[model samples]
Target: MRAYLATSIGVACTAVLVLPLSLPAGALAASPAAPPSGRDAGVRTGPGAHSAAAAVPGSTESVPLRPLGSTRAPGGIAEQGVAAREVRPFSLVGVVWDDADDELRGTVQVRTRAVGSHVWSDWLEVETHNQEHGADPGTQERDSGTVRGSTAPLWVGDSDGVELRVRAAEEEDETGPVRPLLPRGLRLELVDPGEEPEALPYPPSQNSPETRPGAESGTATGAESGTATGTPVSLGTGVSPASGTMTGELAGPAAMSAEDRASSAANEGLTELGAAEIPALTKAAVAAQQPDVAAKAYAAPRPRIITRKGWGANESLREKRFGYTSTVKAAFVHHSATGNNYTCKQSPSVLRGIYRYHVKSSGWRDIGYNFAVDKCGNIYEGRAGGVAKPVLGAHTLGFNTNTTGIAVLGSYGGTNPPAAATTAVAKLTAWKLGLHGRNPRAKVTLTSGGSGKYGKGARVSLNTISGHRDGFRTDCPGSRLYGKLGTVRTSAARYQGR
Candidate 1:
């Protein structure tokens, strides 16, 4: 049965009073003596030796404790218990003892080998008796006690010895009386091996198959020995067939199946483009167009992109750097709070300020958006370009992960966005939609519940563009600017068709 050393009140007392027990002859020396108050007893090791040095403070040595089988006391009461049957001679396992309360309780097991001999099959029994007078006139009152059953054998002795065999009472059984079985004061003996060899459980088997040797054995067969026949095979298990086995030859690209050839062609196409492809395309397109008079578009200097400093650089922005492939299910717009009272030329400074606040002070690595538009209608880049390539940005909670981030430069909450800025944003949107092969004027549905501010109504696809507050909890783009999302989309469509 599973048994562990229990530290109950009885166990505590047992640990306390068991001190001062005498050591067996040749047992290791007693530990440093304990004070009269029984405090500061250090750890003890030797058999039947009480060592204050070995005892922990406030702890006492426990008497040998054991569990007996379930049985009823002579009376009708059901009692379950165990007895310490025998202590082996010269055995390292120790004797039993009781505390000041006269309670017989505590675990007794083999101590470490350094201090005592390991003895197997050892035990100590305990019982209590009534004091009575016998016929002998000169004799004082005598004490006679009844016998309790033996404890299960605990293994002890050399490395091969049986360890302590402990058992516990079943749940249905009651613990027997401590009084009669264990007297207030009684010395327990330590037992050891005699002469007859201990009874072993089962003789070890010598015919196990694993111990055999040869090519046919369970062990691995090497290539030189050539025990295996057939082609070398690489099963996922790492087993390879013997050498001189035939494996199919590799197929050349020309010999590939139709599907494989098609896949290879696609991969080659992707590799043909270099890192500068997107930027070059953007520059060429802008150069071919006339600056919109309404937006007053002009070329802006490209800012030097900074990588996150220090160890933070290692974090990947692959998703942000490469645009992700997503259905342009909807579009969201917002105004940079810092640009509330600023003009288009001040956009760079605003961006720098945002970077300082988010990256330097707030510990973010980069500005978190896909693109930013200025009052002059110039579209400035934000976040790693790759994120815009195929992945959405984290601009708005919940919706940002799926929607593209487009920030306008000024506060539009109450006042309308600059006509130039609005017109520029429209032209930019048309260009982007064309690149994705979508018609800017396509009829689409806009759901208000996603952002929660708009009332329910069916709007055209051009009306799908929404302000940031439409999908997130924010006063983005100002109250005046946010309401014009539909108009911006319609204007962008008209410009693209023109």
Candidate 2:
């Protein structure tokens, strides 16, 4: 009889051979000095005699039988027997980070061992999914000593649990030459493993559950849960045992007010202000305007009302602009300060001013941007549509060489631009993206010429519009207006239908 053992650590695996004891026939023979009981000789035997006979073979049998303890049967000696082997246990290690649900998510490492072998095969499968009902399973191969997985872009609830499984080919199988053993390990780790949990913003109406915590029985609407009463509710922020309307010390940016959340979403292009909310937001922008703020709006020279001077009103200008032929691979956004405290009606003059600045100050022959938007959200022609002919402008450094640029009025860096402004940016961005056959939400970056500052290139998306600071080194737009670039970008993306 023999036994085997295996062990593993990190990438190294090893196995050891365990020797078993050999029992002789003579050792199992009954002792001659012991008196034979009646039962021992097929007669009425006492308990002592029966015990001795059980431990030793009788004279009638030439070979004595011995009990095997935690040992495998001898090879080539077939008989009904059992064998026990000790194999090394496998281990998994990894780190988790905050996911969309305010839950913790991360990667994991996996390894296994076999009896009597030092080499481990990379033949393992890994999968992960939320423990909640109706969750999809994500699968991956164990590559380069690690397995990675991620959750969906929404909260998976308080009991967000993950399961992992492992399988290997078995040693023997009569049906085939080999069989596979199914051994699995389930790790129920908290997504947010930090000692102090952070708060997560409520999911959007599209992805949020419909029912509020205290609502009576009702049907769930897609990701959102609906209550008997007509209101919908979001899962409480962060992962915890308590379930109800979220209230307590807020943590992280998730604690922001509804206005702040709306601002953030608008900047990110994740959501647009509702139509009803747009008017109020516009009024707020008008009221929020500070008189002391630099009023450089009327600094630029106004365009002549003759023949073809203003945007769409000029027929000769349209004839001069080129048609859209070259692929518009990227886009750049800017702000115009030509008309101080101007309304949407002044959009034409604003476009003319931008066109002049690009030609006169930047040495560009035409307006740099493809489009321009006013404070009231009116979209005007700049390069592509202002004239019939294409007019390339020098806008983004290295990037604008073949990119399209769009300019909006007023400085967004200081305060949140009006809803109208954001809406116009979104519509214009979406239209341009559709015309150019590009994704509005896709990220754009300047690959050459500009300094590595701002992460080596100006990385932006079509959905989230930007001011001049996002790419070029100079502050073409004032600092107050430039500060809100991210918010504007987000808001624009949301409007782009992302």
Candidate 3:
């Protein structure tokens, strides 16, 4: 993908950032400072020595799958996977291959041993047809030459031992049963989200601003005072040229990378540099920014959203620059399919794991979705440009150009989605869609960029708010959750004053 340099803020495009690649213990700082009691407590603090695992940067272990031999299956199973064995601690797993264009026409199942325990769990299925969510087939991001085919990541909590299998589907032929060919380069990926980073302080202060082309007159952008008046400002120690605030790690050139500055600058209008979360805005506050839309009574109150920083994202893990599309025409909803075994308290860890999987394991530039919601109704920023901007996402394959993706954490194929989760989806869509003057209840036609269900340039009409299955032939946003789209649309429209 084309990387947008932070030249606007004086960040040199050629700056090199050297980072460590060691897989430290407690690599994913995943656990909360104080985990909740009961079942969740056990998940974070498993019985035995693992309870005190040190927090450190996360790591990935990719093991090749091998044939299990004739003794394993009745039909001489046409399968490939690793036998049960102990290894480093990891909380998520998936299968990936070298070719992004090749599809895995088979089933993937994995079983695991809980960290520090000998008990082995039953085999759990992984989503094999997850290629429906990716960059458009021929975009620079899709053709970045590093993309790969991967299954939906499965969260298995803390585990040190794993057994996995990938079985090809058998079909009846004239001679007998025949098995289809499996994709090449099949490997099981074990992911450790690593230790969660320390939470940044709330109400983050803007960092010290650097010299800009037009700022020699002491005048600053409206990011600080909400209006770009020619106000004279003093530039000194701990003083921001835009807003005289304390200079922190995020603003100091020595402390921040060029990528970090660009990311923070993208959200300058909505938050201060290095802010953890974007504060919720009342309808009046939102209306004040758009008087015309307010006069038309067609705006939704901005929802509170947790920034990537709030979720402890290691920005260094992703590509150094950002990508963007022209506008957000629709919102495609999805279910993480990572299972519902986690508590709201562990949501950040979940996000971090997924982020790491999408980048390091799946061979993507960043997390596929634009936003993520927890079962408890918390909203988080997904891809790193700007929440309000049309940040090009690796979601909805052919439809990634002008649409945003919102994934509610957890699988919903059999289980019903929580009311809070659906409600948060509605609230988020209402505000984000309103920004582009889209009516969640309206229908819009989008041209396909080449997906399994549609060819490039094929025009299809769909809801402004639709499920992941709407654009592809996969069971995403599951049946139970997909059924809730109607309610989400109605609620979002109402919130937008439609």
Instruction: Encode model 3's per-residue lDDT on 1-498: one tens digit a residue.
Output: 101111111222211122232223234323323432221121212111133333336767777778866523334446888876667788888888888788776678887767765466556777785578788876666777777889888777888877788988776678787776677788888888877657742332221122211223123243332222222222111112221111122332447664356444356567664667665554434545553443235556556677887777766566655677766789999988787767676788889889878876676777999999988788889997778767778878888878899998887776688887898888889878877778889999998888888888999999999998888887888888999999999888877766
**For residues 1-498, what per-residue lDDT tens digits would candidate 2 score against the true structure?**
000001111211222112232222223223234443321222212111122323221111001112223322223111111112111121111111122112121112222222234333231111111111010111010111122122111111111112222222234556654423111222212121111112211111111221111232123342222222223221111112121111222122555543233221221211121111111111112112212122111011111011111232211111121223233455566654321233454344334433322222122223545556666655544552221112244344444433556666643333345665655555445334433334455665434333223433445443224555555454434464455555554543433233
Overall lDDT per candidate, in order of appearance: 0.32, 0.29, 0.68
- Number of the top candidate by lDDT? 3
Off by over 4 Å in 2: 1-325, 356-363, 384-391, 412-416, 449-465, 476-496
Error of 2 at 41 (Å): 99
Which is the better candidate, 1 or 3, if ranked by TM-score?
3
Measured by TM-score, the strongest candidate is 3
TM for every model, in the order presented, reads: 0.34, 0.32, 0.77
How much lDDT does candidate 2 score?
0.29
By TM-score, the candidates rank as 3, 1, 2
For model 2, give the RMSD to the true fold: 32.0
lDDT of 1: 0.32
Kindly list the per-residue Cα lDDT of model 1 for residues 372-486, writing each as its tens digit: 6666555554553231232334354334323456777544444567765665555555544433334444544543212223333323233346666655445665576666666
Residue 35 of model 3 has an lDDT of: 39
Which prediction has more favorable lDDT, 1 or 3?
3
